[model samples]
Target: MSELFENYLACWNETDPTARRALIERHWSEDATYVDPLADVRGHEALDATIGAVQAQFPGFVFTPAGPVDAHHRQARFTWGLGPAGAEPLIVGFDVVVTGTDGRIETVLGFLDRGPG
Candidate 1:
């Protein structure tokens, strides 16, 4: 669960579109969906595009796990922070992930705790 959530943050920081897509392929189930305040997306292509857009918008920022993850019954939640490496976060959010029966991510529900100016 920890590794998977870390990959979620990695997806946020990955600047290479191909690499990010690969990450999505590796970690997400085919029927996966992601939703937050700003957007709702489904499938690998949409998830990849969403991650790419975020990287483009926050050029130098890296997303990192902000706290310990809690998981049970195929569901897990964790907080993440976004900023330059080693610096204070300008953005923060919590995400709840639901793993499929096969243990791949089936859904991600994100809640923004903070956002950059």
Candidate 2:
């Protein structure tokens, strides 16, 4: 699970579009469903659009994991960040649930802790 998470972060950090897309193709299942704060996408095609949308909104983003990386029941949770250094991360302690078997991610659900002021 840690390996997968590590690979995910690495792929995300990669600047090249081809490389990132390849990583996504390799790790994500064909029918994978990706759920985030704003979008719920299914399949690689949809996932591609979802990624584009996210990148459009948060360019040069990365996930800053906080605490342990647990993959029990095919799910994992960690923190994520957007923007450059010294900027307060838009989200903290974000939860990501990846649904799949044998480490092949079939679905991902993300949750952000952003409460009212």
Please give the CA lDDT of all the candidate structures: 0.89, 0.67
Give lDDT tens digits, candidate 2, residues 17-107. 7777787788888888877777888887776666666666667665555557766777876655554446666655465757567676786
Model 1 misplacement above 4 A: none
lDDT of 1 by residue, 5-90 (tens): 87777777778888888888888998799999997999999988888888788888898889999999899999999898899999
Clashing pairs in 2: none
The superposed Cα distance between candidate 2 and the true structure at residue 41, in angstroms, equals 0.3
Q: Give the TM-score (vs. native) of candidate 1.
A: 0.95
RMSD list, candidates in order: 1.0, 2.8
Task: Report RMSD for candidate 1.
Answer: 1.0
